[model samples]
Target: MAFVQLLVTSLLILVTKADVAIDIENASSDVYWIGILANPGLPIPSNGGFVLNGGQTTTVSVPDNWVGRFWARTGCDSGTNTCQTGDCRNGVECAGNGGAPPVTLVEITIKGDGGQDFYDISLVDGFNVKASIQPIDGTGDCSTAECESDVNAACPEQLKDGDYACYSSCAKFNTDQYCCRNELNFHSLMIIISPRVPLKFQMITVV
Candidate 1:
């Protein structure tokens, strides 16, 4: 499989108090279809999607209180507008649609409660590209959140999705323990498995 990496920067400017700037960069030699799914009633940036070629970068502006998830679609066929992984089944522009799993997700809630920003790189849906977020300029305990390891290289046989992605245990087995579907303490389980923390960022990268 070809190695793919994306670098994104979320630039929070002191002057632009009402908006945030997201700089998405494709650092690898591959074409990536960007997908953005914003909260209902909120405007979607770039009409919810765009394309980034290798070494190319694009900036998207959103409200300071924007809440959404961003992901990249790989191995996309322009003719059919579908991807081998992370396909939303709606072409390049997701338009509020989310990508299919085995996808690495960058979830964020800007200017959230108590005037804090929360962001995380999630693998609960599985893993396609190695991704990370780095906080540039922000208040409070700003730290990098990442899933930088090559999960696909070390994925167990049962969780392997060909050579492109790795399926999470829950996605592969659909069991209560893995999915926390029927668990009474689902929230607790989630915290143990995937913890969310406050983070401010200007850059995101996928490898």
Candidate 2:
């Protein structure tokens, strides 16, 4: 997946050292199974996954230094515990496993250098849904990272995964250039969004 390197600076204000509060909501009409993947040795919230019905919201707490990613799995079967998109292949709880490609991701790192938190929305895997992240009651430059557009509507015919999700060129073709494998700088991988569509949000690196 594409990675965005965020730069965070020290703040003069006294930052309270506590677990970070993450509020997740399902803004769409479809039922969503929220998946969590934490860094190795870190705790995975909600045992790695949970279900969120339409318009439902839930909160999860993570340590100040937690590092992880979150995504939503759609078209899941309750009996089989599988999903048409973003399935981890191990049932509802990913148990630290990441979602399948062609899924939207919200990546985060809490309390890094100088007590700054870093976050971004990545489509390097591809776009399955419109997703966003907003900081609530935080200090310093806490900007929202989001992609509000319906990318699936403009997804190229070749990149479409049925009618449910869109695949990144790299995921579909596995070419070095599309995957940024040729680049020596590992931090700035280039993701190619279809030029035929107008993206509503630029991939953001926020502190």
Candidate 3:
């Protein structure tokens, strides 16, 4: 079976107006990977992108209002900035560019939706590795969000055979149910959607 290492994270966020720190921990036994961050309407993150060897930790700092998504590039050559899985610019920094589609993404929008921070593990782009986030300092019933299973193993026919990720069925099928979000078709669509992993979003309420 063809296997690929995808970027997946479960973070426990403690939201505040102060600068935020992100610590990336690599759990792989032998893969050399780098983390890529792409910010929208903000400057490139200081850590922007950095290499992490097996069992290494790299930390980055971002402003409170920063909104962006992060993903990992596996089997990458820091010297070349080329990744077998999530390559960005021809260098370490992402230069504010998003990763190629079908890549697993961990996205966050701080101070969104009634002044709450929003975070999610999205499979809409695709499914690769597992991901989740926990609030480190905060209060509320904000559930831990995650997607750890590899959906590619059972990827729908049209969306299968991707590099190592599985595309959203709606993205590939584009039917009335998947694309239009028709309530009438929801019941019938559930069966088709049931097998696929569900994306998760968490809203953190700061104390």
Best by lDDT: 2
Report the lDDT tens digits of candidate 2 across residue range 96-207. Answer: 7788988888778776667677777788778887766656556677776667677888888999999999987777898765665556325345444557665733323321
Query: How well does candidate 3 match the true structure in TM-score terms?
Result: 0.72
Relative to the true structure, candidate 1 reaches a TM of: 0.81
User: For model 3, how does the per-residue alpha-carbon lDDT over 22-75 read when each residue is reduced to its tens digit?
Assistant: 666666664534444645457566446666667675666677776777776665
Off by over 4 Å in 3: 1-17, 30-32, 78-80, 170-207
Model 1: lDDT to the true structure:
0.69
Candidate 2 ranges beyond 4 A from true positions: 1-17, 183-196, 200-207
RMSD of 1: 7.7
How high is each candidate's TM-score? 0.81, 0.81, 0.72
Which pairs of residues collide in model 1? Answer: 5-206, 6-206, 8-203, 8-204, 9-202, 9-203, 10-202, 10-203
Better of 1 and 3 by lDDT: 1
- The clash numbers for all candidates, in the given order, read 8, 0, 8
Deviating ranges (above 4 Å) for candidate 1? 1-17, 184-207
